[model samples]
Target chain A: MKKNHSGVRIGEVTLKWFIALHLSLIVNSLAGVASKMAGKQKFLSFRFCICYGMVLVITFAFALAWQQVLKHMSLTFAFTNKPITIIWGLIWGVLVFHEHVTWKMILGSAVILLGIMVGVSGDSGSDGSSLPPEGGKGDV
Target chain B: MFEGLGRYIAVWIVSVFISSIAQVMLKMEANREHASKLKEYMNPMVVSAYFIFFLSTFLTMYALKYVPLTYSPIIEPMSYIFVPVIGVLLLKEKISRRRLIGMGIMIAGIVIFSM
Candidate 1:
């Protein structure tokens, strides 16, 4: 019974982390979308101010959530996950910007997705082992 | 300052570097335990990091105005490369072999996608 309970707890924790990580990614991508939208307006115009202001607010949210993610994951893994935004950007481009995706782009995105899976799977360590002690010299 | 391709590359790299610094600073901020107060948001490191990031963003926008179609592909992924290296040197983040390979594959994928 104890073993079964522990396994359930682990599953719960994994699910919680999965939700948190993806939330961060989506929010980060939204910030990019906001910034891109802001770029379309004239600088210092009221519309520009509104769009850019939204960007700032959304970016603050992204930063906060990203910090939270780093608390649970290693810097290396988190940093590597930065490329995931590219996939989001492509999706946004197609849906929002009406951009076309060529075959090369699709193949490349698939490779990137594969890479993210490999990277995330390589680490079972909960506490980012690659993250060094604060202000401590890293052995590299 | 954005006339030539070389200058554009320089500006793009500088912007990426600044962005990487911001990334590291945010990571450092994350590792700390702070109270939920206005003062916490006013932390000097966090503020400066944001300031630098804003500057980087502005420079990128400006640089793009001059060379948007030509260099956008390569320049965008430069940060993915920069952050990990900066994270290692300045932030003392270690990289395992598997993670390194993963990063390489991701980067190659991005380069291809951008192309």
Candidate 2:
């Protein structure tokens, strides 16, 4: 892969990129669901371990997918789309966890959706590089 | 001082901000070149980033004991606000007008979501 003068490669937006982003979000949200399930068990108990194990696995997938996302999109674009995970959370809550949602929560989610749409508007073929010109490198 | 929804928001904010920092670290780790591709994983910064990310995930789960799944999503946007600020301050990445606008809108959405 060839990097530009800025040492960052430009991304070409494609259907595969979109699909990967959504898949990442879905897997990321599942980590939350798994965590919630783990909360019901005693810490480090058999049940807790199983639930937490699921969290770890799902999170591993999320991290891997997120790296792919950053390769193809800017952090701003990638983070902006993260709110979609809320919808997935709500779905899991309603369908799997049987959690209740109030009307206000629905309204707030709608506004968040609007904001996500506006945030991503006209972002295609734009400055999607992940690194700056003068980069910082060190271990923390 | 924080309790109920306020506490959940606070925890979520911390988690997302830390996660964004980890994101930047991973991106930096990605930029470096190594003879052995697997050696990249051994970079201290990358390892630190993943460790920080693990802590963030733990905090998220801890907060879930108090927060419902539906409400937790509202806090996810906090990273959108945080990542750009850190990008500018730490990474010195340039921000475009459109991105600024998008971030502004996202902030507005967060405010409304918090209500």
Name the candidate that leads on DockQ: 2
Q: Is model 1 an incorrect, acceptable, medium or high docking prediction?
A: acceptable
Q: What is the TM-score of chain A in candidate 2?
A: 0.70
Candidate 2 residue runs with Cα over 4 Å from true position: A1-24, A62-83, A121-140, B33-36
* Fnat (0 to 1) per candidate: 0.27, 0.34
Per-model interface RMSD values are 6.9, 5.8
Report the lDDT tens digits of candidate 2 across residue range B64-108.
776777766567655555666788788787666766776676566
Off by over 4 Å in 1: A1-24, A64-83, A120-140, B1-13, B25-46, B60-78, B91-93
Local error of candidate 2 at residue B15 (angstroms): 1.5
* Model 2, span A1-140: residue lDDT tens: 34555553334345567678888778777877898888777888999899989988887677677777778866656655665777887788888778888766776777766665565554553545432211111000
On lDDT, the candidate that comes out on top is 2
lDDT of 1 by residue, B1-115 (tens): 6568568667766876777777677677867888777656689887887787778765654454344322333445555456667888876877767767867886787778667
**So what's the TM-score on candidate 1?**
0.65
Cα displacement (angstroms), candidate 2, residue B71, comes to 1.3
